[model samples]
Target chain A: GAGVSQSPSNKVTEKGKDVELRCDPISGHTALYWYRQSLGQGLEFLIYFQGNSAPDKSGLPSDRFSAERTGGSVSTLTIQRTQQEDSAVYLCASRAIQGASKAKNIQYFGAGTRLSVL
Target chain B: EDKVVQSPLSLVVHEGDTVTLNCSYEVTNFRSLLWYKQEKKAPTFLFMLTSSGIEKKSGRLSSILDKKELSSILNITATQTGDSAIYLCSQIQGAQKLVFGQGTRLTINP
Candidate 1:
């Protein structure tokens, strides 16, 4: 794809339900990230994946939130037993590669999936 | 912990006005600072500043990083209605994670 792509632009689920959001990053990109954006809030880093390294899950808010990247391309963010506070836009971004230069830090974002837990 | 902070939570200006957005950060192993313009759901990439005192410009939009102060400023000249959006600043950690600041919402009226 020309840019990062996310599935199910919108999702409405009841509290206690589980929701899975998918992201397909740009071709050949080796780094991917997942973030959460609440109403009137900034992007909250959730997880990061770089090639074969273990994902950095330091930012996951709780045990209910988990994510995995498959083959270093497609990634999935699963929120179990969703609560009202979990309602937000889940964004995915991908960077070309990791390096010491600024160019490697540029991340392209997807349209994001707006999840509403009622 | 790595943190990024942006000032002036929101601003309103008339078209053709110039606006400056500020961002400060305190992060260990800071590799780069980036600016992004988000209108709706997606945030479009703008400038990536690594070296201090060098301004990165894109037409009406320009940005510079001050490594000494651990801050950056994004300047928009002759703004248009289309420039009305949330401007976000983020600091890239050496681990390849980006710590984002609360964005600045800019509204340009015609």
Candidate 2:
């Protein structure tokens, strides 16, 4: 509604089980980003979508990580055959680029989904 | 590759102590540098700096960006326990992506 929102605040899944996390960005905001933070580590950029197209997926750690955005609003990040090392907090952020304001690039972040692969 | 570097990855200080966090970017065509304070899971935005040498201040927190050095600094005066959190520095890179540093973890003891 007023800010970026994410789903499945906490998820505990067995190894090899696929998990899907969702993100709903601020309304009418065009740019969306997904990042992963391992324990005691900085955020690692996973992928970003600019109007349903991901121009840079270079940060995806491996083939097991995939993401997609539909309708340029809601985005989904999926992990295939998850492993223990895949456990981390997945954060989603959104920013508005429709205006010429200097703050247009400021990203509003979600509470994030904490995934634990057991 | 565009990346941000932060110094003093971890710091512990008593209340009322002043501290300065550093951030440097290695991004080409850098648009802006932003500072965020992350508490728990969500990170709250603090400041966005585009022009050099202009300091943005909010209460006990202040930040300055230097375009010539490709660096920025976040200064906190009269720190309190509530100010303890992960301070993140991000650079606006190509395609509107935010290139973030490893983050500086500051802990303030009461």
Candidate 3:
């Protein structure tokens, strides 16, 4: 793909329901990230996956929020027992991990999935 | 805790007017500062500053970083109505994660 792609641009789920968001990063990119953006709020880092290393889940708000990246290409973010506060936009981004070039550190973002838990 | 703060949460200006947005940060192992412009969806990357005192320019948008002050400024010259959007500032930490500011909403009226 030319850029990062996300599935289900919009999702409306009931409280306590589980929701999964998927992301397809650009070809050959080795680093991927997931973030959450609430209404009128900045992007909050959720998890980061680099190659086959263990993901950095330091930013996950709770145990309900879990994510997995398969084959270092596609990634999935699953929110279990969603609450009203979980209503936000979930964004995915990917970056090339190469030399020290500045562009390598730049992240390409997907359109994001807007999750609304009623 | 890593922190990024942006000033003037919101601003309104007439077309052709220039506007400057400010961002300050305090984070460990800061590797770069990035500026992004967001419309309805995800934010698009604008400029990434790694060196202090060097200005990065793109068309009407320009940004400069000052590591000594731990701050950066984005200047938009002769803004247009299409430039109306939210400007976000983020700090890259440990070359892995990004810590972002609350963002500045700029509205340019015709």
C-alpha lDDT values of all predictions: 0.90, 0.91, 0.91
Look at candidate 3 and give me any clashing residue pairs.
Answer: none
Tens-digit lDDT track for model 3 on A49-87?
Answer: 997554588889999999888898999899999999999
DockQ-derived CAPRI band for the predicted complex in model 1? high
Best by DockQ: 1
Worst lDDT run of 10 residues, candidate 2 chain B, spans: B50-59
Predictions ranked by DockQ, top down?
1, 3, 2
What does candidate 2's lDDT look like per residue over B1-93, in tens digits? 777999889999999999999998886676788899998998899999986436799898999988779889999999999999999998877
* DockQ of candidate 1 compared with the true complex: 0.85
Q: What is the C-alpha RMSD of each candidate to the true structure, in Å?
A: 1.6, 1.4, 1.3
Per-candidate DockQ values are: 0.85, 0.76, 0.78
True contacts kept of each: 0.86, 0.64, 0.71
In terms of TM-score, which candidate is strongest?
3
Model 3 residue B7 CA deviation in Å: 0.9
Candidate 3 docking band: medium
Residue A40 in candidate 3, Cα distance off native in Å: 0.5
